[model samples]
Target: MRAISMQEFGGPEVLRIADVPIPQPRGAHHLLNVSRAGVNYADVHVRGNTYLAPVTLPYIPGNEVVGTTPDGQRFVGLTPGGGYAEQALVHRRVAWPVPDDISDDQAVALALQGQSAWHLLFTAAGLRAGERVVIPAAAGGVGSLAVQLAKRAGATVIALASTEQKRHVARDLGADAVVDSTADDLTDRIREAARGPVQVALEMTGGKVLQATLAALAPRGRLVVYGYASGEAATVVTHALMEKSLTVSGFWLPHLYGDRGALPTSMEELFQAVRDGDLKPIVGKIYPLGEASVAHSRLAARDHIGKLALDVTR
Candidate 1:
């Protein structure tokens, strides 16, 4: 098997294509012949050894993939080992068989981002119907799904994207309103779009964006912090939250990976949504497996929208 192996934690340059023994599945795990590997911001953090979980040296970085079995069954899943390879080991509990109508790219998009978006809103934030929700980074993989899912939950979605094109994508996904995070009046814009202070804010990028979104939350509102894509930490004051009785919670997908059985329901719901024409997975770009470093660079650069995937067979 061919994989992009990391011998040390550093930057994209550290990922190198190397030949390795094919992974063997045990117990509930299934061997996946990977077609597409989803590259995420977590992979970038993994390369830098800054992820929430510790990664051993000389490991592969990808967390999710869409692939087939020797029996020709197509599946999408989070790989227990690594997905930046021609093949990977997917725990059967986390693996969902791909529908005949869903392409590998679409299935791969649903693996991590789909699961993350679902958990962020329903599990972490406890989103309620008729609430006003704000989604930061609304054009990226998770954000795209977050926009659609938030709307489906009967929430008025105020999607924040960095560019107009991304904002357009958000609107097409059913966002009630879209705000450009880079706009000078982002806070006011979001509040105006929501028609009031938002009831739920899905904060991803840290720094100014998080601070602004926090300020835009309604009284007794909930803010679910998922990632710090801005590479800067956002400081929160306890007094500020206490004044408004606001709640802030952090969500990391790895925390739920231990409960393997917890994933199928959400995966099924996500797939069903896609199948029902209620959700669309935006696949921005596909790179060859050997260009894994390039894929990482593009993701880190924030040059692409939606999910960027690596075609292992290419």
Candidate 2:
């Protein structure tokens, strides 16, 4: 089996292609002939050794993938060991049978990033119907799904994207409004674009964006911080939250994956949503398996939109 191996934590250049032994399944874990590996921001963190969970050396970095079993059952799932390979292992409990109508790309997209979006909005943030929500990085993998999922939950979504092309992508995904993510008056723009007070916000990009989004929140507003793509720490004031009655919550998919019903239920719902045409997973650039470095580079640089994947079959 060929996989992307990393011996040290550093930049994207650290990832390289290598031939490795195929992992055999134990207990209920299934061995998948992986066709496509889902590339995510978490994978970038894993490669750089900055992930919340410690990563072991001589590691192959990939969290999700879509492939077939020995019986030809197509499934998409979270691979804790590694997913960037010709074959990978996923416990049966965490794997979901891919819908016949869903493509490998869409199935893989729903694996990690999709699961994160679902949990962040409905669980962590406690999103309710008819509320206003802000989704930053509106064109990226998780952001694109967040925009769609927020709208499907009957929330008015205000999407933020750094480029016009990305903003347009958000609009097409049913975002109620779109704003320039890099605008100087971003906080004001988000406030102006909303129908009323901004009630719920998803803040992944850190630094000034976090501060601006926090400032734009209404009294009693809820903000969920999931990632800091800007590679900067967020400054939050305790006194401000107390005075405004605001809530700041953090979400990491790894922790949620441990819960019994978390991944299975959400994966089923996400796949069903995609199959029903109510939700669309944007499959962005596809890189050859050996070019994992390129994939990491593009993701870290925020150069791609929607879900980027590695075609192991290539």
Q: RMSDs, each prediction?
A: 1.3, 1.1
Q: Which regions of candidate 2 deviate over 4 angstroms? A: none
Clashes in predicted model 2:
0
The best candidate by TM-score is 2
lDDT of 2 by residue, 23-62 (tens): 9669888899999998888888888778988888999999
Model 2 RMSD, rounded to 1 decimal: 1.1
Superposed model 1: Cα runs more than 4 Å off: none
**Relative to the unseen true structure, what is the Cα RMSD of model 1?**
1.3
The local distance difference test score of each candidate is 0.90, 0.90
Measured by TM-score, how close is model 1 to the native structure?
0.97
lDDT score, residue 190, model 2?
94
